[model samples]
Target: MVTATALEAELLELAGAVPDPELPVLTLRELGVLRAVHVQGTDTVDVDLTPTYTGCPAIEAMSLDIERVLRSHGMREVTVRTVLAPAWSTDDITPEGRRKLREFGIAPPRVRDGSDPVPLSLGPTRTIATHAAADPDPVHCPHCGSADTELLSRFSSTACKALRRCLACREPFDHFKEL
Candidate 1:
């Protein structure tokens, strides 16, 4: 006989394993999108999720997937809630997600400490200064593992990714933007 607590544990594990539709290479756990999972009652479970973007279409897919996973496990009443407060930040992405992004030929958002140096310049120089902060951290070339890279476009195939070209490997790739 499976204990309620034990079942809840299993449910949590299963929910964590749900994959993101946009970034199929990473699970919700790695993406840090599964906020909470707990047993609501004898036959009920509740799941809290934070979407990468508020308007992200992937959220709907992910919510449906979470429900499917729990219902498949025999949960009679499953609730997948979207939590908008403390909105999702790229920093929320787990280290595993970062690694997966790199493996998938997408550079992960760099961590920011708030103390990163900001340059002061005006006129055309302001454009250059802002550009420097566009990617506050080093954008390593996913193809050749070199730090030499250039931002080809602020937009990519997805709203959250920017297009970048690697100087070393002369390859183009998407960079997961920082929130």
Candidate 2:
């Protein structure tokens, strides 16, 4: 692992502070996409960024934002490289980010053990039950805090989120899907 110099760390923070284009509520750092920043020369720097998923549409905007932020911070040249290896996962999201998402009326992705296989509910939405015993970690409604929620659609406003409806409050919300 490479240790970051004080200057590099400061630049990283500036880059990380850039708000995500798709999710304005969360910064790139909170979203866990801003990987690292390396100073290449006196005024040039290179940054590593990972997308939430492969071919994420917001990547270009994210790169541009990072470059703009760095340039304004006195960086003569800034390059944002998207790295695919060590894929980005929902688990990478920080606790603060999750809380912000929930406060923003979006259900945050649940934490999971990477080694374990995810439990799959294969039955029809209406027939399936969301019992506590059945689903230990049910996607609770961000609005009413109810576990009684059903998936309305696999895709929502963005590819990363899914549309879900809370049976209790009769409200629709987006749930950030576990990557």
Candidate 3:
């Protein structure tokens, strides 16, 4: 007989392997969206997830993907829950995720130092991270592999990306802004 712990481990592995709909380059584990996977009983699995941002439209799709992946793998009664506290940070993105982001022509965020640059504050007593909303850091060129890039706009095709133009290759690309 398979122990609950072992079953849960398998379930977690399966669920964590599901890729994000918006960020197809990274899996839930690579994105650090997967928080916890616990077995409540012999047949029930519970999962905790956090979104990249509060208004991220991909949250619903991610949740549904998690459930679908688990069910297709023969697991039943899987529950995916999202939590907002301890807010998600770009630091949560894995090193693999960073590599994948770069491979996709989108520069990944720099290593986080516990200081996030998000604009909104959860509430009083919460130290809100300050981002350079106007002029952002100089982004590197993912095309020609040069650091000579100029920030065209702080916003990109997605809320998490910044538009940049490479001076060397004269190519335009998006930088995955670190949150």
Off by over 4 Å in 2: 116-129
RMSD of each: 5.1, 1.8, 6.8
Query: Which segments of candidate 3 are over 4 A away from where they belong?
Result: 1-4, 114-137
Candidate 1: residue 19 lDDT (0-100): 84
Number of backbone collisions per candidate, in order? 0, 0, 0
Q: Rank the candidates by TM-score, best first.
A: 2, 1, 3
User: What lDDT does candidate 3 reach at residue 97?
Assistant: 91
* Candidate 2 pairs with clashing backbones: none
Candidate 3: RMSD to truth: 6.8
**TM-score of every model?**
0.83, 0.93, 0.82
The lDDT of each candidate is: 0.81, 0.90, 0.79
**lDDT minimum window of 10 residues, candidate 3:** 122-131
- Model 3, 1-179: lDDT tens digits are 54447777788788889988987879999998888777876666788899988978999999999988887876678888888878888889889998899889998887755584656433443122222353355456778777666767777988988788776778888888878
The candidate, 1 or 2, that scores higher on TM-score is 2
